[model samples]
Target: MSELGIHYRRGPATVTGSPRPRQGPHAGDRLPDTPAGLQRRVAGPGYHLLFGGPTRSWPQDPPLGGRGDLVSVHHLGTQSPWPGITHALVRPDGYVGYLARGTDLTGLRAYLDRWLPAR
Candidate 1:
């Protein structure tokens, strides 16, 4: 799983309702081993803005804090397939719609606008 680098903030606990399976993380892959940690939660309906990084790491982005739909996972840099990138906007259905390699908030916003323009 480490090679795949597909870290799930929420995912399946077991295969088809079976008992919790054991998992071991390889070097630098800080994946959780507990059942609850593996369980994939059903994504809530609607557009959910997700960002990966340490909380309070970007103080300049003040508007980011006001969005109630935003989700933050601090370990994204190490867990995501796109390492060294700062932000990713995931669709509500759980696919990466946009990824920015640096602190380019404007690019991120433009990408979002392209998909969903002002209404």
Candidate 2:
């Protein structure tokens, strides 16, 4: 899988001398096809932001502001496949673009800026 670039991770060459398994989903990993009807929810032309647990505390406006049109938000509640993950940004190709451990908007914003920079 590493050679194919599927669920592959490159760790320090000196540490363990090999790739180490990371917790939760990593970038480039395929989104889990579970919780039923998930494909339908994410069916679209742009990226999808899935949030775990209640999203009442999250800002009502899309995080990207004007660039929100490039990303659609969805609340997964407790149906998230990766436990403890607060959010997952799934790319249009069905692979994870980024993963957040908690309510880390700073990291997410950086990812969006890098990949989907605003005009």
Residue 9's lDDT within candidate 2 is 31
Candidate 1, poorest ten consecutive residues by summed lDDT: 12-21
- lDDT tens per residue, model 2, 20-81: 22454565666766677776788898989888756774667756846778899888877776
The residue pairs found clashing in candidate 2 are 53-77
Best by TM-score: 2
Least lDDT summed over 10 consecutive residues: which range in candidate 2?
A: 11-20
TM accuracy, model 1: 0.46
Off by over 4 Å in 2: 1-5, 8-24
Clash pairs detected, candidate 1: 10-40, 11-39, 11-40, 12-39, 12-40, 13-39
Write down the lDDT of every candidate, Cα atoms only.
0.40, 0.66
lDDT of 2 at 16: 12
